[model samples]
Target: MTQPNIVIPPAEQQTSVEAGDLLNSSTAGVIVERTAQVRNGFHAEGRKFARMMAEFVNVKQVGVASVFVYEETFGIKDKLHWLIHLSSLEAYEAMVHMGTSDQEYRGNVSSEQVSQDKGGGGWDKIFVDGSMQETVLMPQFWGMYGTKVDGEREKQTSVYQQQGPLTGLPGAREQVPLPVEQLVHSGNCGLLLHRTAQLEYDFRSEGRTFAREAAESINENLPGEATVFVYEEAFGAADRIHWLIHMKSLTTYYKVLALHVKDERIRDLYFQERIAPERGGGTWARMFVPGSMVDVALTPHHWGMYAT
Candidate 1:
């Protein structure tokens, strides 16, 4: 198999504020998540597969892959999720090409001994048939998505590196020099909330505006405790938007919920949307497709890629 020549930006050149940000990519910060329902009694075995997968993929240097399992409190209780953070769509294509075509990756998966179980049938045995779903998201913020020049990407990354700790807002205090190595896999976030919504036709702009404002509100209220990111689907359902909320811990999750309920800024924004403009509020009712909201919370199952 012919290997694609891949150029990876040095860790220092990449900027990311979330668990999904493993490397800086050219395609507006791509995050590909694969979710699968695991067969009963195979949780441990599934985790082992996740570890192996992450090890192989990260070593290839095409991208970083981390495995997460759904928390019982949210989404399906028995599923494993793998999030692959790549530098670009091209990088993702290369990873897929090499993963399937290269003998190093294929040999391990196809080998009979890949599974430790006595009845070894390889790693595929751990999951239910036809339960896996993959979704592609491009992280977005402000009015713009992730479109950035090489120099802009590098500059943003550098700013984050100098910010020292998450609690310190940019330019709010003296900068602290944070090593690129340490910041790359901070491992501070343990839970990720995945929420999806579908916008009505002609209302995509309004939905995006609301999302941008909501994210800004959350950041202003919580600062380093929690972070909210908006993304538009690069693939999958049309008009579907996604939100990824990275929480420092389980406690932070509850704290965020409370903030949403009690914070005036958040409530006001919702009120404007729910009420009609004629009533001196927003037309949020018309902005989104009813019954299109979905929420799932994921917790780290293994630190395989990050550990390496």
Candidate 2:
């Protein structure tokens, strides 16, 4: 119905990582990269697995770099890499359980059932990391998925963009209709440029303020191709915000970056900056992650919104 705005960034801002000939998104995931432990049935069974998780909270898909996921936080990377949609923390206490055994704290299903329904069960392995109370998601950009009863569930909110539109189905939240240009009608999950980094102390305001500013001033020449979605980690680590942009090729990603660098925009300078003492907190500095990452999940199998 409407044509989405396309954004093709400047020439010098790109990281210059050349990609091979990969037919689809399935070959190259969007955000975080994963190890062997997190792939099997991760994306396909994502929705089904959420229904069975006890500490499950909100869901958000990611697109980013190989941010060197720590060995201690292996599972978080595992989940971030393959999950069709990103899943965050909810704090075990926040969840209501049906009870398995107890004098006072039996919890929901039995340890055996928990094992069976989860990793060992016939479903996808859902990962619940960190505590919700301690998790710091940026509030300025966060909002509850629309709930007018479009057949999606209230227990969990599914936020999908740049795929198709799949949040309003039963057991999920209503789809966030960002722009028609966000989704690719049939071939594969749209190609996206993902970037991520940790934020500094009390820096939420700065992050949001800059994002809004960038929205207006970043790259006005390019429109939908630069349609970017911002997100923060819900579990494991705190304040790791991810920015996923819609640009399909590695060449195009470089083009966006190159554009900024050639013009010597503030965006490129921030890319070299890191959070806190790591580097003088520039915009990208405070968040301090580098490189332009791409989406790497199976296309049709994990559509938030798709067409036949």
Candidate 3:
């Protein structure tokens, strides 16, 4: 029996198969984000908390923790953010256990000693009560593409080999991962734009296809200037999808966004997506749930990589 010919979208043809699979193996897929609103008069204290996390707390954690501050976001002002990259869910579980068991970790972030001004647990003094929120995310597609994924293991191995023998010195026990720019020079990725939306129940696959194609088109047009990542909520709303765009700077983000209308490829894709199905157009808007979108902009804290 002969099969009939069927056309596939150009974006589908160009999409990387690896992008669709969850790379849950090692330090590449899972990201846990922590967010909190800074208290009205605690701006300097917020910075101190970030510095404390970067300098003391993050260094000892099982996963890498990089802190950020929200430059712009929906539903909150003066938000502090923490992005913890881990190997897997098992690692996350282990991290939680370690945080609970380690006395130093507890002392540094202890809610019990919130009133104290000088010692461990002063982190609570910086943020508003009941404003803390945490979300766990997995890269469903288009997640880890840069050297952060490619060279991380090799870099770690090389560092260990060079260490030879332990010598007592300042910050000797701590292992800090390389900054984003050093990992992938082309994708400096200093600023992050996080956009979240919910997909309609029936259009999950269609939404994924559209997002993959749109991301491909943007990357194709802009090249190394920007990159787009798609992540699905692992522990939150099942229908939600996250679109994370990484750019060298805010200026670079503006340039890439302008391409939606200015660039021929993106303009054509947009037009096709809006056209009717009877005219062989794309199906994009049909996949989205109304009024489920949120956008936030994050820049590195003064103590974090590529700090603003």
Model 1 lDDT on a 0 to 1 scale: 0.56
Q: Estimate TM-scores for all models.
A: 0.70, 0.37, 0.67
Per-residue lDDT tens digits of candidate 2, residues 1-308?
33433232221111122222111122212222232333433543443332223122221111221111111111233343222222222222222331332323342222233244444643222333331122222211323222122243333333432257532211111122334444321112234444455555455545543543443333343444444445445444555555544443334456566666675565554564433565454544443234422333221122231220
Q: Once model 2 is optimally superposed onto the true structure by TM-score, how far is the C-alpha of residue 13 displaced, in angstroms?
A: 31
Candidate 2 Cα outliers beyond 4 Å, as residue runs: 1-179, 182-190, 211-219, 264-308
- Candidate 3, 149-268: lDDT as tens digits: 223443443333456652211110111133322221111345667789898776666566566567666555555456665667777887588766765566666677688857886777
User: Total backbone clashes of model 1?
Assistant: 3
Total clashing pairs in model 2: 36
Positional deviation of residue 149's Cα in model 3 after best superposition, in angstroms: 24
lDDT of 2 at 261: 67
Instruction: Provide backbone clash counts, one per model.
Output: 3, 36, 1
| Candidate 2 to truth, TM | 0.37
